[model samples]
Target: MTSLKLVIIFATLVAVSLAGVVRRDATDDDDDSGEEKHHGPAFLEGLDAATKDKFKAIFRDHSLKGDAKDAALLKLATSVLTPEKLAEFKTHQVEFKKKREQWKADYDAKYAKLSPNAKKAADEIKGLWEKDGMDRAAKKAKKEEILKSLTEAERKEVQDLFPHRGKKPSRN
Candidate 1:
């Protein structure tokens, strides 16, 4: 592969790894909501424990710095994302994006038809989310209240549209 391509790949992996680590650290509290934060391929869920441990070891190597770090990361990415696997992942991403857009459109259409009270509740929840300085639990509780305002069918439709809802999260 081209040197620039390798550099880009390495940089992207490092950034994702760093973000995951930081997010994990920030949320490592007793009050954490039982939610798994996943920001990568679904195949990552299929990796065996031994392979996952090897990947962790690569990131934990403190001696690797600068270009060495980049090189090591690139090597790791190359090994993990084989040509066939990468092709499948790219296809999956494209399909997922299309499905997400369709779901958003459906939700907008359904929401536009809600009764005045339900609409008002949804608006209040949106306002709460957009405002700064609100605690997560409070916001979530308020949002749930808004959902409760909806009819049973409407509530089920909304839950169905959300990819992360109504399904057990895979352990990282």
Candidate 2:
């Protein structure tokens, strides 16, 4: 075999060996500490343990992130489920997506009505919340500063984007 082919074959063998050695019992709780982790909805309880463990692997796949991960996971999970379970699970997924879309639309409408300064403040807070580097305390302090500067009406409009989740958190 060619030298390059030998290297590729050697690398593949090493990877396969390492994977076998590193593999853990998927039934053992999703975490290293052996605590059961729930990756799917409660309805998933109807699924067999092996199937449920398959879902857990999708959630833990580090290669996917953000919306792409969500979409890919949904597709994979749907493909993996049995016909009987797939129908209900797909329906649930559709309902969830509808709710998320509605929420985003509602928030967008409210944001469009804000004053220029209010828009800027809201955007800044969103940026800080998503971006890395800044400590959470520092980010919150900066956000609270902008939030406090808002007119009461703007505050009401921009307060907790996910208000349905709970009371507006005390910004203090």
Candidate 3:
């Protein structure tokens, strides 16, 4: 009789544990479903025509603003987003931030090894980056001048020395 009672108690405990695991799994599924709903294209389809037009304009030119831009974004969000999709987007944003930080660290480490003259030139470039509200035309001209001064061999050597500096892989 005691053995029978013990068996029954063990069986009950096992069933209860299994039930908790199933509940947790269900909760996880619900969260994933919510995220999927937000990321899915169905929400985008919900925006009004006017909102869609505004969104298109913004995409073509970033300078567009005022109520039109606001309306378009609002429409896009309303049409496209569920709470779940927003959460998923937020997750991606967090990952991007982490990557940006890592890249900055690598850049700083690479910059630390530059020769004194090279460092001075890099500092001048850095100052340009630091200058707030600088005119874009002047900045472009300065950048062009810097590039124009470098001989092909010097550019190639620099690119070789700093693998991250060039857009393309060095042939040599």
Candidate 4:
């Protein structure tokens, strides 16, 4: 599971970095011509000025340019992400799914034993989660209340089962 999570996280980072590259290249289009410009790899756009300069030096070292540079970067990425590594990730993913299912089953059993009012609140939250018109802040507050009602073990299990879902992205 950890391996799968890491792959997902890495893929997300790569996509975001590539998006920065695309956005930067899009904005720097030549006014007089329709030809697409080869700005280094999309990953470079996400770096700070100093980091960019450092990478520029490295690019010069290899004498990679335009399409060749893109191919080089792609080759580098593929080489690092080997089939064996991906197979390990798949194994971890299967283990994680099994564990998450067990946790969810436990959560259901624990939820059934909650006090009536807590159960009511949980049901309401579940209903709201299924539908979509509620105010975001109100839904968040209700969700927090529902979590607070859980036993410590249940809460921990829930957190472990979905660690990334509720988190906000960190500022770089």
The 10 consecutive residues of candidate 2 with the worst lDDT sum are: 34-43
Query: Candidates' lDDT values, in order?
Result: 0.67, 0.74, 0.58, 0.61
Q: Give RMSD (Å) of candidate 1 vs. truth.
A: 20.0
lDDT of 3 by residue, 44-90 (tens): 34445564455456545544444455455555555555777555544
What clash pairs does model 1 have? none
TM-score of 4: 0.36
- How far does residue 6 in candidate 1 sit from its true spot (Å)? 63
TM-score against native, each model? 0.43, 0.55, 0.43, 0.36
> Judged by lDDT, which candidate is best?
2
Better of 1 and 2 by lDDT: 2
Candidate 2, residue 57: lDDT = 76
Q: Model 2: how large is the Cα RMSD against the reference?
A: 19.5
Candidate 3 worst ten-residue window by lDDT? 34-43
Residue 21 Cα positional deviation in candidate 1, in Å, after optimal superposition: 38
Overall local distance difference test of candidate 4: 0.61
Residue-by-residue lDDT tens digits, candidate 4, 49-123: 664455456466434544576455445444443565435434544665687678678768867676665566666
Q: In lDDT terms, how accurate is model 1? A: 0.67
lDDT of 2 by residue, 55-158 (tens): 66766765565577668767866677777677777777777779878988988887888788778888988888776788879998988898899988777666
